[model samples]
Target: MAPHLGDWRGRYRGAAIAVVRPASTAEVAAVVRACAEAGVPMVPQGGNTSLCGAATPGPDALSVVISLSRLKRVRAIDAANNTITAEAGCVLQTLQEAAAQAGRLFPLSLAAEGSCQIGGNLSTNAGGVQVLRYGNARELTLGLEVVLASGEVWDGLRGLRKDNTGYDLKHLFIGAEGTLGIITAAVLKLFPLPRATATAWLAIASPAVAVRLLGDLQASFGSLLTACELISDLALGLVRKHLPGSSPTLSPSSWHLLIEVSGGDDAQAGQQALEAFLAEALENGTVNDAVLAQSNEQARRLWALRENIGEAQKIEGLSIKHDVSVPISRIAEFVERADRQLAQAFPDIRIVTFGHIGDGNLHYNQSKAEAGDNAAFIAAQSAVNRIVHDLVHQLGGSISAEHGIGQLKREELLRYKSPVEIEMMRAIKRTFDPQGLMNPGKLL
Candidate 1:
């Protein structure tokens, strides 16, 4: 019960009357039915790896937490159809392994893939580094099995890519953050595993340059380009300081781009092509320095630097984190303006920016120097959020990108969302959970 009560980031601590582990979809339905009969609120939790407190119950509510960790099973794999049916509690890495064992690829990946369950990934519509090629959790999903707020099982888990049969009800629950219903099982799309891959880390002048390099890579490689991540000097510095020896030292630059290209069935061909592109970019002065991974082990080491940014930040200290997204064309402008404004408001502010720049999502975070009191720096989260989120909104972007509107950003959701949009979301909530028992005080 205690382990299931808190979020991964240590930002949210909650209380629940009892935590019940349901072994199957039927057991989940029974748990919901029993809770519904007593009119008790319920929180459907998976992995408990939510950074935004999405899985944590409210502190005051005596709700029943329905843990889906027990429902871990890979139901079936249709290699011919390129789909895998898995239970909600199936760990994301496990699903990826299962897909690989079936001679397929499940590309929905993130840093928390080792522990985070597929249920939470679907609920949050998670976007990872591979979103540039594979798309997010929502895009990869074909069907879902949900236990509605009324304790009724809705088995819509069909592995059909072309189901134009009435409304696409599966989408209503995906990215809904479990406010509508509990996802029990899902049929996810898969792809042919890439035999050859090319990864490189490039030191660029700034975000503008990174964006430009992204364009050039897209023009040259097209669908072969799988991931393009942008990282700031400060963000890398933290990783180097806290997690020493984890990443190789590279040329010092204001910004860095970690890009990968995968295709074909031959490794040398892919590497040669990427190497040629990098050499040309270097000669043209677009790239300051570049390191193309010589082998698969080296590529994994390079990716570790990008994936460990969040953990490194935690070790550094408390920071105000903002997961925002803008159009790919406007990323440079958003960063330039936001950095200036935040620096002016809080002097000597250490802003750490990094994320999937290919998809326009940036994890912009801020903390103070070693001499400064981080407690005081964290106290200014509201002012920091205002400067960052307002610019994101002004640039026609989203306040909450991959991280959903959990307890952390409920107010920001209202602040940025239009009245009409808010009303529509509320209407959907009312329609799905009329009794308001499904994960209350969440996205709505």
Candidate 2:
């Protein structure tokens, strides 16, 4: 008998001979060794929040899943060093709260923060709403402790801000999607907790204007611009319909921008700066309408709309989803070209587009308005992907953005990546896991 493999979205399912829960790093190493001896592939999973099916094992693969849920522990925290060392299974939200309790900030955030684990975040190199300011999970990480396929543990966890001894081996596994090795623990960077914050929701004319507004805000506010998120009208409609207590922000504009500014112990000054920025944006017609939050509750309400987009889409029904990114300067062109191409290809289709415009990543999704023919729409995924990904390639963009090339985009990766880069990746994989037992059939 084996444990049933369940996908996060229920779209793909698999089965494994056993699901082993290791409570410590040593235990994880032992499990890996046993699996290696048996010549069974191992799928290392944490939180199982991967959107790209990377955590789900295939039915044909003889595998044992190493679930790290029990390895949750905060090994150490040094506020002076501005770093926190924690096990692979620590939930991201818990780590953030722990850092906050110590008067520091762990700024890696996503919609699944409550359930997603740090190891999974590192494996995927997650980029969330705050990427515009704090960068991606890879940027936030300082070091990692990984369990290689041969059961050897690579202890590279150090909290130093400056280290240039030799080759940065930790970088090899940060976004490798567990193909090379299993991450056991990590030393993550922390930031100073901003004492004051201001949030605003602005209605913009189109993606072009949204890009312009992003430039304006970045030029004026600089590092104080903590987040600049983009949401489209169709995506917002899904939220208002499915999620309770959700309402329209600005009379249903075509596009919306959620902006935040934060600094040290000066709420009034932050608010003033936001007001001045918005005033100037309005005077120059950069924004059509704007609403600033006067209270924390109000700010939370504004964020709820942006956070609920994925949930709303799930409730609506099956969709062909894409997590793509282009240069900030080419976002408008990408969107316009993608829209026209998709519409012409599928006349009776709905495009629900939205994402972190400041980071040039968009969750461009498509499905039928009527729920009855979702299967047909989903079946057309290959054709649709060819069209969309071709455009992304022409624009010098990535087909997969925050989401890693799990089982879903493995072929696409080969199609887009150069032969030399692919060979280099294969070499690294061999150097780390020669047997190909660690998270087989992923990334490379």
On TM-score, the candidate that comes out on top is 1
Clashes by residue pair, model 1: none
RMSD of 2: 1.3
| Model 1 RMSD, rounded to 1 decimal | 1.0
Q: 1-444 in candidate 1: lDDT tens per residue?
A: 789888988888889999999899999999999998999999999988887899999998589999999999999999999999999999999999999998899999899999999999999999999999989989999999999999999999999989888999999999999999999999999999999999999999999999999999999999999999999988888888898865655677999999999989989999999999999999999999999999899999899999989999988878899999999999999999999999899888889999999999999998888636678889878988999999999999999889898899999899999999999999999999999999998887
> Total clashing residue pairs per candidate?
0, 0
After best superposition, candidate 1 residue 286: deviation in angstroms? 0.7
- Where in model 1 is the C-alpha error above 4 Å? none
TM-scores of the models, in the order given: 0.99, 0.98
Worst 10 residues of 1 by lDDT: 243-252
Q: Which stretches of candidate 2 lie over 4 Å from their true place?
A: 1-4, 246-249
Error of 1 at 116 (Å): 0.4
Superposition TM-score, candidate 2 onto the true structure: 0.98
Winner by lDDT: 1
Model 1 misses residue 440 by how many Å? 0.7
lDDT of each: 0.93, 0.89
